[model samples]
Target: MRVLGVDPGLTRCGVGVVEGVAGRPLTMVGVGVVRTPADAELGHRLVEIERGIERWLDEYRPERLAVERVFSQHNVRTVMGTAQASAVAMLCAARRGIPVALHTPSEVKAAVTGSGRADKAQVGAMVTRLLRLDAPPKPADAADALALAICHIWRAPAQNRLQQAVAAHRTLKGRTA
Candidate 1:
């Protein structure tokens, strides 16, 4: 499956497209950021994000979209912009009938780095290594976006499979007892 992962921000929203399935290597299709002046009106910033998503939809037409869940930060204004930007991304995905998944920053970090407390630099380093990229994805936000997509792919059904395996192991041990 192909997925477009987005990290929404008013100043610089990161986007990444990755294609793969469970047990298969996910390859980077594209990674970039959408930008609007910090001073730009909220509506204009949302339009910018919408336009960016539309462009990606036209070019890649990913089957699924993954966006970072809106988080309330200390700055209410920042949080508001993020929510607006995220809404635009979700709307774009919905318009195309593409399924959307929203993951929290901690969840993405845990999936990528095996720790929910991982900082941006750590996640970025792991993402670069996981994708086997020569260099870190440009701009920290872009790397975070790619990591978010990879995390979703790794944790989705794969988590269930792992749980099943553990259950089976326990059952076998119980039978032998």
Candidate 2:
């Protein structure tokens, strides 16, 4: 499976593409950061984010998009920007009919580093080892994006089965009712 992972931020949105299946080697198709000037108006920044995500979707042709889920932070302003950027990513993927998954920061850290409390350095190290890269990706955001993709590749199968089971149970319950 090919996945495009997005680490959304108003200042520097990270984007990475990875291709692989379970129990197989994964390859980094591409990795980069999308930058929007902080001074830019919010609408302009959002538009920039949309264009960046759309370009990635067109170029990578990913089957799925994994985005970092926005969580509460003391800085409401920061969280709002992150949530906005994340929405832009989801919209871009939805337009192309690609499946989008939102993984929490802890979930991504655990998946890549075997610990939910893993620090940025630990996650970067694990991502480097997993992808067999000589060096960890830079700016922290890039590594984060790759980690999100790796988490989805490893978890999506079981997640899909769980979703199917829930849907089946709902259908059965409705029929009985």
The number of the candidate with the highest TM-score is 2
lDDT by residue (5-113, candidate 2, tens digit) is 9999999999999999978999999999999999999999999999999999989999999999899889999999999999999999998889899999999999988
Model 2 per-residue lDDT at 156: 91
Q: How close is candidate 2 to the true structure, as a TM-score?
A: 0.98
TM-score of each: 0.87, 0.98
List the lowest-lDDT window of 10 residues for candidate 1.
Answer: 154-163
Q: After superposition on all CA atoms, how large is the RMSD of candidate 1?
A: 6.3
Candidate 1 wrongly placed segments (more than 4 Å)? 158-177
Residue 38 accuracy (lDDT) in model 1: 81
lDDT of 1 by residue, 1-177 (tens): 788889988888899988888678779999999898887777887888899889988888888888999878799988888898889999999988998888999999998899999998999899898888998998998998899889878776875587799999999999999
Cα deviation at 162, candidate 1, in Å, is 14
